[model samples]
Target chain A: MAWEARSSPTGCINLLHGDARNSTSITVFDAKGIHTYQPGWLYVPFGEQDPHKLQRSERRLLQRDIALLSGDAGNVVRIDPAAKQLQTADGQTHAYDYLVLATGSRNAPEEVSGFAEGADHFYSEKASLALEKKLANFTGGRIVTGVASVPYRCPPAPLEFTFMLEASLRDRGLRGSTEIHYVFPINRPFPIQSVSDFVAPLLEERGVQVHTFFNTETIDPEHKIVSSLEGEDLPYDLLVLAPPHKGQQVIIDSGLGDRDGWIPTDHNTLRVKGYEDANLFAVGDATDLPVSKSGSAAHYEGHVVAETIAAEVQHRPIRELYHGRVACFLETGHGQATFLWFDYEHPPKPPKPRRLWHLEKAALNTFYWQLIPPGRV
Target chain B: MAATYQIDKTVDAKGQTCPMPVVMLAKAIKDLKPGQVLAVYATDPGAKKDIPAWANKTGNTLLETVEEPGLLTFYIKKA
Candidate 1:
C-alpha cells in the first residue's frame, strides 16, 4: 500500500522484496488439504485455477506495480530505523524518508518440544500441503489438533480444520473409528466469548473432544504423545500442531523490535513507538498490535499506515487511527462457512454458517490476488 | 440484425482471476470517452458473472458478450 500510495502523489518510491515470487494464502493453505481428502479443488472453487500459476501471476503483477517505484530486486538484510537507511543483499544501501516494515511472521516450530523434528504443522504452505499425504495414508486412530501458543495468525483456523477433518473422515467412513481432539492453550475454545459459545456446542455435537488450558510443553513424537506443561499427556496417531509464531529476524537485528522480534508500535497510529521522529511504521503479523494476525487485520493496518504516511508527506497531521478491524470465516464443514467479524473495541459477532458466507470467503482469494499485490488495498 | 458499434479498447484479462477482470476493466474504461465501447477478453470463470455485475453497479452498459473456447468476451459502453 505504501509503495503505490506514495509513488505518484509524493515522489519516486523504491521498493525491495526478499522474494517476490512466493504468494502465500494461509486460509487457502488450510483449505487446500481438504481437496486431497474429498472430491473438491479449493483453489479452483476459490477461482485460483492453479496456485503456483496464481503465485507467478501475482508476482508479475507486483513487479509491474513496483516498476513504478524504480526499485531494484534485492533482499533487505539490515535496517537502521534511526538512520532511515537499509542495506540490501545485493551490496547496496537505500535511504528512505519513511520506512514501513511489513516483513510479516514466521512459524517458530522450535518453540514447541519435538515439534520441529517430529510433528507436522499446518501453518505454512509446504507443511500444510504435506499434511494431505499424511491424511491420505492414515487408516484410523486418534487425531490431535492443538496450538503451541497464543497470538498465532488466524485464531479460528484450528477449529475450522477440526470441522473439515471430521467432515472428511465421515465422508471416508472413518469418523466413527477415529477419535478427534482439539487442544487450546487458552481456557476457552476461542478468544471471543460469544463465538466460543456459538461453536462449543457445534464441536460437541460433532464428537470433537475439547481440551482447554493444555499448555504444550513437550511432544514425545517417539511415543506419539503430546505432554502439557502440567504433565498431562494426550496420545495420538497423528498430531497437527499450530506452532509458535515470531516476527522477521531483520526487525530484531535493527533493534526496533521486542524480544520476540515483533516491532512495538502505537496500536492506533501504527507508528513504531520509540522512533516516532524517524517516521517508522509496521503492519501485519510483524507488529505487536494485540489483534488476530490475519490478512483482514493487515488490511486495516495498511489503510491507517498509508493515511499516516500520506499525512506526513503532505505536512498534515496524522488523524486516521486504526480500530483494529479484522474478519475470518469459520468453515463448518460440508460447504458451509460462518463469518467472524470483530475489532479491538467490538466483541466477535459471527454469523451462522451459510452458503453466502462461504461464497464470500471463496471470493476473497480473488480479491487478494487482484488488490493486495498492486497495493490498491 | 443490429448495427455493430465501434470498439475503442480491448482489455485482455485472460488468465487473470475474478475482481482483476473488473479492476482492469474499471481502469481501462476510465480512459475512454462517454459511449465508447471497451471489450474485455477473460478466461476466468468468475468474469462471466462479475463483469456484468460490475457494469451494472458502475452504470456502464454491457453491450455484447461472446463465448469461445477457453475465453469469454464482454463489451461495455462507458456511461
Candidate 2:
C-alpha cells in the first residue's frame, strides 16, 4: 500500500541492505560499527501487471533480485532462544550484539481441533498454496471461515480474503450457486470498537454474517463439520480457519516467553525488561508490548533499534526511542482503503480512532514507496 | 529570484517526507572531500522543517536557508 501511494506522487530511495543477496546490499562488521538510516519497504500485493504506466516503485521491484525473505524463509533456525544465537539450516552462524527478534506469532491448532492434522489446513506458505490449489478445483460449494483467535496478524486480512473471494466468485458468476459465509468471533468487524461500530453495519450490508463474541472450540475436519464451545455445528466444504495465534515455541521453551508464549518488553523503549545489558529487543507480533503485531510495528521498531545500534558505536547515547507505534490499512474492497495510526505514549489506552489517521497508515504508504524504492543510504 | 539547483545527475530527494531527506542529505554530504557544499531544492512541506533540525542534530552547519514562493532552498557547509 505504501508502495502504491508513493507511486502516486513521485520519488525514489537508495536502499542499502545488510544482506548481500538483497539488491542494494551493504555489509559492515558488527564489531566495527555502522550507522545508516532510511525508510524501507514492506512488500505489498500489487505488482507490475497493468497495461498502462508502470509505477516507479513497481518498476524498482521488477528490477530487483530474489529476496531471502524475513519471517518465514524456513532457512533460519533457532539454536537457543534464550541465548539468541541463530544457526541457518545451511550451517551459517550469526551472533548479534544487539538483537531484534520479529519472529512473529504462530497459530494454535490446539485451540481448534484437527485444524493442523487436516490435509487442507492453510497456515503457512506451503499450506497457502495447497489451499489455493484446492480452491481452484472447488467449483460450487459452501466456504466457511471462522475466527478461532483474536489479535491475529494483519487484523483486516480475514475480511480482505472474504472480499477478494466474493469478487472472485462473482467474477466466475457462481455467486448464486456458491455459498460464502464468514464467521467472526468478535461482535465487531475489527480494529477498535469505534471502527467496528461503523463497519458492523457495512459487513452485514455486504452479506457477511458475523457471529461476534463467540468463543470457538473445535473443528471436526471429517464430515466437513465444525462445532463451537456452545455446541453449534457449522458445516462447510472448505474451512479457512484463522487459528489462535500464540508466541513461538522456541521462546516459550527457552523461558524467554510469558505464560502467553510472548516475550515481554518495555512498551516505550522496546527493550526486553530485564535484558538491558543483553542488548536484546523484540519486535513485530512476538513481543507482548501493547501494540498491534502488524509489520508496521516491526518497521517502526527497526528505526529506533537502528538508532540504538548507531549510538552505541559512537559512544553516543541513543537519542531516539520507540513510541509504541502501529499502523495499518484496511482494504475496503473496490480499490478504496481506510488507514489507521496510533502510538502508546500519549494515551493510557490508544483510542480506536478512525475516519482519518492518514499520516501513519495512508500517507506513510506513499512515503514508504518513494523512500524505499529510490533509497538513500 | 533564488538559486536553482536542478539536480540533473543524482541526489535529488525533492518532495520527500521526514527522516528521508534527513537520511539522503547525510549520505550526500558525507561523500564530499571538504569545504564542499550541495544546493538542494525540495517541495515537501516538511523538508523545509526537517533539514535544519537534522543539521543541528548531526553537527552539520546549516549555512543559509531560503524559502521562495513554491520552493525550498538549503545551503549547508559540510563539517
Candidate 3:
C-alpha cells in the first residue's frame, strides 16, 4: 500500500520478492501497477470469508505473484550490504536503490533425529506445504506443536496454530481422540513476562497441556518423537515445530550484521548502524530490531523507511522513530479473540476487550495474502 | 433534515490506550443531534477497532472508514 501510494509513472520503484533473492522469477511475482504486493502470493478478494471483516477489493494489499520458471539459482554468492546488490550462484548481479530486507528467517529442526525429513519437505512454504500434506491424514495420535528454540519469528504463531488446529480437530471430531501437547522452552507459554504472565491463566483455561522447561535438542523422525536437551522424550505422530531461527549469513559475511546474522540497525531511523553514507535500512526477519519479527513491525518499519527515503529524496530531514511498536490478535476458540500490543518497553500488553489491535492479525494475514505480488513490503 | 456540529479534540493518554478511543468517541457523540455527523481521527490505531465497535454499540451509522495509506480517517453518522 505504501509503494502503491508513492509509485507513479515517473517513480523509480522496483519491488523484489522471494525468500532468497537468487531466484526471483520462480518464487515471486512483481506487480508495479500501483497497489500492494508481495511474493508467491496475491490478495484474493475479501468477502464472507475475508479475515478483516471488510469487503473484497475495498482493501489494498501486498500479493505474492509466483511463476515457477527454469534456470533458477539455488544460492546467493554475495551481497553488497551498503550497495544493496546481490550476486547469485549463476553469477548475475541485481541492484536496487531502496531495499526491504524481509528475508523472513528459515527454520532448522532441533537435534531430534529424523523428525523433519523428506525431499518434498521444508521449513518454509514450499516445504511447509509438503509437510502439511504429510500430516493431513493424521487421524488419532499424539500431535506435538511447539518451538525448538526462543527468539523465533512470530512468537505467538505456534500458539495460534495450536488454537487453529484444536478447532480443526473439534470440527473433525478428533479432539477427544487425539492428544495435543504444546512443548515450549520458556517457563510460561512465551518468554516475555507480560505475554507469559497474561497467557498462563488463559492457557490453563483452554486446556492446552503446557510442558514448560523443555527444549527439544534432538528429533527422532523415524520413531516420530523428540528428546529434550534436558533429557526428556516426547513422542508424536505429527511434530509441528518452529525450528531454530538464524540470520542471513550473507548479511553477516558482508559485515553488516551481528554474530546472529542480523543487521545492526537504528530502531528509530533504521539506518544501518555505524554507517551514515550507507543510508540503508533493514526490515522483517533480517533486522536485529529489538522486537518480535512480525510482518506488522516490517509494515511499520516500511512506512518509516519510506518516509526517511522520501526525506532524503527531497533533501529534507528524516522524520521517523520506530518506537518498537507492534500489535497482535490472540485468537481464542469460539468466535472470541484477544488483542495485544507489545514491543521493547511493552512486552505484549493486552488490549481491552473492545479494540482493533486484535483485528491486525486477520487484517495483516490478508495484507500478506493480497499484497506481496512477488516481493517488497 | 440537516444537522451540523463542530468540535476540536486531541487525546494522548500515553499510559492509557484502547477503550480510551471508544470513551473519547462516546464523549464526542454525546451532544450530537440527529443528522449531525462526527469525524474522529486518531493515530492510536486502536480507534480503527474501537470506533467501529462504538458505532455498532450505539446503533449509529458508519458512513465510511478511510483507513488508508497509513492514516486512519473515520466518518460516522448519528443513528
lDDT of 1 by residue, B11-71 (tens): 9877654334665676577688888899899997767766776666557899888888998
Clashes of each: 0, 10, 42
Q: Which digits, one per residue and each the tens of the lDDT, describe model 1 over residues A239-264?
A: 98778888777778878787788788
Model 1 scores what on Cα lDDT? 0.66
> B12-74, model 3: which lDDT tens digit per residue?
322223433444455456567766677766565656665675566557787776655655656
CA-only RMSD, every prediction: 23.0, 22.0, 18.8
- Rank list by TM-score: 1, 3, 2
Docking quality band of candidate 2, CAPRI definitions = incorrect
Stretches of model 1 off by over 4 angstroms after superposition: A1-54, A57-59, A63-73, A317-319, A375-377, B1-79
State interface RMSD in Å for all models: 21.6, 21.6, 19.2
What is each candidate's DockQ, to 2 decimals?
0.01, 0.01, 0.01
Could you give candidate 2's per-residue lDDT for residues A25-80 as a string of tens digits?
21111111111111111111112112112133233332243222222222344534
